[model samples]
Target chain A: MEKKLKIVGFLCNWCSYAGADLAGVSRFQYPADIRVIRVPCSGRVNPLFILKCFQEGADGVLVSGCHPGDCHYQEGNYYTRRRMMMLKDLFCFFGIDKRRFHISWVSASEGKKWADVVTAVVEDVGAALRGSEKQ
Target chain B: MASTENRSEKNTRRESIEQFLYRLLKEGKVDAVLVPKRHPGGNIVSPVLISEPSQIKGTDPLAPVQTVNAASIVKELVKEPVDKKIAAVLRPCEVRATIELIKLKQLSDESLLIIGYDCPGVYNVKEYMHGIENREDKEAFTEEHIHDFLSGDGDLVRESCRFCTYFTADSADVDIAWIGVEPPGIIVAARSEKGRRMTGGMNTGDKDAPTVRKETIGKIEARREKRQKSGIDNLLDLIQPCIRCYNCREVCPLCYCKECLLEPEKMGYTSERYLSRAERKKQIRMPVDTLLYHLTRINHMGYSCVSCGICEQACPMDIPLGTILHVFSKKIQSLFDYVPGRSRDDELPLTTFREEELSEVEDV
Candidate 1:
């Protein structure tokens, strides 16, 4: 049996988490690679969380938040977007593959979009893992 | 805008500064003066707190070596309110760090006098010590170093100083200008009411700042910008030798967290967990998470990093930690148009958010 790639998804409660739930309810198909952890808001996701996931052997990390101006706490997603973007740049500078860590905005109403995003993320992460194995 | 012109025509630069400080103490303007001084052995120079005017004899505030950022010392001294005011003579970096500390509530400005000067930067302690080992008068080291640096002999200075643009204490209450001025003279300009009050009795003459100062500052900034651009690419390579000793965190003036999350207990690692992690990774570094530690600090202190570079001095591995930090911070701070230690009124970037800002950072 081959080792399974572990993808950690941090979903904001107001939008992305609900979007994930809606995907399940609507019977949308997506990869089971991602293990979702629902946070109060994307702003609550510290940069340390992504680093910790990587350190604990996560092959990929995805942070999904409410769209700008649609945050449950008014501006949490905006802060998250700024912070995560900077963190992504930092990871790139650290020589980590940019594909391993990702951030996106998915509203609660977009269950189909959520499935598509997850499918794309899982594929990218799986590709990265395969590339590393060959190396 | 009270600027102090050179009062004495014959005194050397060091003598004039000493005289100015001596008078401040003698006239009872400040209860104590915190300045660097040569030890009785005449080898090392360190910060000293002198209450009496006569005790200021060995004071050499312009030494070309900094043992530690005096802002941390100021934090300790001013943690409690003092009955009498104390004056601190600090470098540009120290002044900026003190300002950041003041905003952090770690140090109070009340009953405290901040006197800062134009800095030519300092040599690392070991380098300075080695350079001055055969010298007869260690007191002349600062003047000699300045002359050499201005003459383009910069190998003696620390790497951080070579690329430092903030060579003037723009944030200080009182700033002493000397970079482009004539020798044996310094112009003191008071930026705050407290500074004005302290210098009211000095009766020093006023002179217009020569335009050469601006040109000199611009040249240094251009050089630094060039150096920084080239050095940023090797940041990961520079930090690869990190032993995870956490010396950088300990030496940082802005890392004031009493309970840092990087601690082993906070990281939640069991004894067996290391073995398991090593098994999973095939080979785990003995002291793990060096990159995480650096990133966490950069995130925590992004807004407060004064770029003092004391962390680089403390690193045993000789990593140019300051350059790495400054590169990241300059980018993040520009995102918010924020400069740490610019002013007490300038809100920290992490604490405040504007509705229509940072759209470029978002994925829409």
Candidate 2:
């Protein structure tokens, strides 16, 4: 059997974490690859945390927060938006595969969307790893 | 007019600057002046805080060497609200870094007067020391450097300085300009109201800086911009030699964190944790997280990086950190239309955010 790819998911407590919980309650099937870590808000996800995930041999990382203007504590995800964009740019510049890292918005009501985001991220991370191995 | 002519009569630019500083002290315009001067027996030039008037001799602001970015020293001098004003004569990069420090709240400029100068780039410390040792008249080497710089011979300066666009003090209160001036005399041009107040009685030369100075600076900037287009593409390979000495962080004026996450103790690695990490990878790099350290640092401080090249200067492995960080920070700063050290009013990129900006970063 092939070893399982470890994908770290940081979900904001009020929105994304609730969304993931809702997905489980509704029996919405998604990839089992992600190991979810609950965070207070998406803004709590430091860029260092994402980098540390990669450094610790995580195959991929996903950060999910509330939609802009929908934060439990207003404007947390807004700052996260700017920080993640700069981090993504820096990662690309350092030759890190940009596809392996992902960011999305999944609100408490969006259980189906949470499932979709995970499935897509798992597929992307798998493809990216396979592509790198061939090279 | 007599003082202007007398200044021109001085043998070298160093003597004229010394005279001006001496007068500033004697006239009690400033309580103390922080300027770079050689140590008692060594050629290494470092920032010295001189309160007495007679101690201004041997002070060389135009020295083509920077052992440490003087902003760090300025931070120490004015960490608390100071009662007496001190004038700091600094290079353009130092002035920019000082401005950033002030904005970051790492420094208090309450009793600080910044006097900036037109820089003619600098050699790395080793090259500068070698040149000074070979030269009989130490002052003559600076004159030779200026002459070479004016004539477009920038081959000898450090790589960062060669491609530096901000080689003059546009943001400084009072600028001591020597580039493109006739007869090699310094021009003291006050750029701000505070600068005007500070330089009210001082007479270095004609207050109106020549039009040629702007044109010369424009030419150098254009040349540097062209060189900057081909930035360091292989940054990972370039930083491979980094021994994790933290020299870059130590020397970076903007890296004023009292508790750094990059410290080994902060990582809290145990013997079993190390073994597990190696087991997981089948093998692992011993001094782990070198890449992680660099990336995290850039994320934390890239917005505020002044690119003084002091980090590059302090690197033991001689990594091209200055050029890499300069190139990286330029991109990051441009994303938010933020220029570090450009002004005091502009908010740091990470500190403030606009409601309707960066919509592309969020995936719906």
Candidate 3:
């Protein structure tokens, strides 16, 4: 039997976490595979944290933060944006599928958008797993 | 390229630079001079810290051999404040690394004088040692290497050196400008107040930077810029030969962790954990996590990597770690428009960010 895909979501407390709560309250449907880990800010999310998740058998990882100019700490999301962009390239350079790592911006009011982003990420990760199986 | 007539003229100027160091010692401008000197046995050269003018006799700052990045040595020498100043003659990379170390609080730059010079490049240590062992006049050999480099011959140069664009020590307190200058002569320019004070009354005939020097440096940089575009497309395949020798970590000037997490004590697993890990990975390769180690290093130090190429030299596997790091760091640095070792005033990218910058990386 194929392993059930496990996704880890790193949601910022000020926005993304609240956005996730809104999604749940509104009964918006997204994959149940994602296990949420609330961090103080997206800037607190080290590249090692994501890599450790992969090492510990996470099939996919989603990092969602406050929108670009809306970071609660002013520029925390900007740092995350730069760091994650480089990390994504680093993963590809190491032969890891880019689909396995995703970054998005979701605010407390954007519950519907959050659900859609999760659905898109899970589908991409599923496709990646199938492609690796073929290989 | 220096003409034959220019070479002879520059030889005299080279001697004057050496004499200038001797005068610095006599004048007490510095407590000591740190520069590479030929070993008494001949054919071998290493950095020697000399306090006396006599000991400065064979000081050759232009030797195309780098035993280690001199900045680390500078770090060791001046980790604490000193009563007297020390003049360190360094290559551009060494000077740059020193600046970074200062920012990291690893080195106190107060009582140090950095005299940086134009570097043509260096050969791989093993290759340099082999090439010089049979030669009677090692100085002549080094001279020939520099001559060949200036004349468009780099067959003996290391791959990393060939790809380097920052050959001149623009960030150093005092700079020796050789580009676009006629042979046997170098123009020394002071970039700081301390530099101006030290070189003052030394009679080392200073001049304004030549107009042609910028264009010469620009041309070399443009050539290297083309090669910088080639990144390691298959990093995993390239690192497959890693035997877990920790040599790269040992020699990296920027890898300054007192307790490295990659050490055997930290990374080594118990018998049960090893067996379980192997089971999980489905017959994992022995000495597992080699790829993981490399990736972790890239993530940790990729931002500050100055492309000194010393780490690549330290690798037993000849893994081209330097070029790989340079490629990765170039990408990361560009994301924030951050250039490591550019200046002490420039904040580290990872430690600081602008509110308006890097918005393109934000997901919609």
Candidate 4:
């Protein structure tokens, strides 16, 4: 049996956080491996903050915010997306499993998609973990 | 050995540089000239822009030490719609800083000329002067006296300049290489088109600065050898005295941070990290990455290093910051065949990234 991965989900209150709440209200189910931390905005997540989560025992970290242009603080999510893209690119350039970090946009109406993305991210993290242990 | 020029000639530094610029100002060769002078209070000095030749009387070209990079200010000075060219008087470092800023598009070269001088390193104004001794003893030093006063065989120099190399200009448009200690005139090395063109008129002095250049070279090499032996430990010692006072960064001519990303506000540094004595080591927040900031800036801008020692001159701890930056800059330049100020056409390493680089080095 494979060990369960501990994934951390940082959701923006304005969009993804509410969307996750809606997922629960809509009875959409996903793996309980994810622990949600509510942030006021996605732009509040600094790369160092994400790295800190990984260092503090989070096997995976997912940042879900409003779509690029729909950021509550104008270009907040856009900045997050750009900086995250650099981090993701850098991680992949190194040999780190890029699947460990996922960034997405899910509005309040996207409860089904929210469950689907979270389920997919956890599944990928579990796959990477098993692959790492085999070595 | 030939030009026996000597004396505390009645001519102030104002007269020498301005006398040269007077003709240019009259000939419309330059639109403006930027230099520094002892302010009205007779103590603090800063770089100022001089437009009229008549107003050039207050200029001091041979200030015993300089604390600012006048080159960045020159870039700022030239932003106007100039009808003609502008000439800037830069210590070797300031000139280099100006060129780096120019490459970054922070400055324009459309109508700009540089007059770079051999830098006789300056005091960290607050530390060596105000912090250690009397304020009115300003008369105690002179540039002619530097090679003697800072011989280091007898006494420590103002720690910063003593450790710095590039005390002379290798990259100025008009290099005002000082000939010798006595007369204190310069051997003008012209490496640019504008420099050669403008000098077509003046009865300029010959190149005697390099005769002293060998001695300067010897002194600098010895310092480098000693620094290489002791730099890491020397750097480790500075963390104690460094009060996180951004004086080094603030006074750095090149540390032009519109919003310094390293600021606690910007980096989101918190106070609780230092709660436990043992925890300090785990998260040493003491001016976090102070060394890295200096190193990165050097890596970022050193190749174009004008050899101006202003960064060292600015550190309040009297950290020989410029020496470290120059060391890295020198090493990287040798590694990559890059020399700052050799040609404006050459691309800076940070600006250009090759896809195929390090393929040969991968096996090593």
Q: Give me the candidate number with maximum lDDT.
A: 2
Looking at model 3, residue B58 earns an lDDT score of 81
Model 1 CAPRI quality: acceptable
User: Which of the two candidates, 2 or 4, achieves a greater lDDT against the reference?
Assistant: 2
Top-down DockQ ranking = 2, 3, 1, 4
Q: What is the descending lDDT order?
A: 2, 3, 1, 4
Who is ahead in TM-score, 2 or 4? 2
Give the C-alpha lDDT of model 3: 0.81
Instruction: Judging by TM-score against the true structure, name the best candidate.
Output: 2
lDDT of each: 0.80, 0.84, 0.81, 0.63
Candidate 3 CAPRI level: medium
- Please give the lDDT score for candidate 1: 0.80
Chain A TM-scores in order:
0.94, 0.97, 0.96, 0.93
Q: List the residue pairs that clash in candidate 3.
A: B10-B183, B10-B184, B10-B185, B11-B184
Q: List the residue pairs that clash in candidate 4.
A: B93-B308
What CAPRI class is candidate 2? medium
Worst 10 residues of 3 chain B by lDDT: B1-10
* All candidates: DockQ: 0.39, 0.59, 0.56, 0.04
lDDT of 2 by residue, B1-364 (tens): 0123343345677777788889888888899999999777657788899999999999988888998899989988899998898999999889988999898899888778889888888888988998888665666677778777776645768888888888888788888887777645788877777877877867465444578977888788887877774445677788788779889888888889899989978755889998998898899775777778788788877998877888888988988888888888888999999888777789988878988888777553
Instruction: Summarize candidate 4's per-residue lDDT along B1-364 as a digit string, tens digits.
Output: 1211343344433356667766667677777777766576666556767778787665666655565678667756764546577888887667767777777676667678888876666655564345224445332234333445335421334454555555666666787655353343545667677787866656355454346656755665586457442223344454445555666566555555577655756544455643552274455546565544444455345556654556666556767565655555565565457766556777765445344342222110
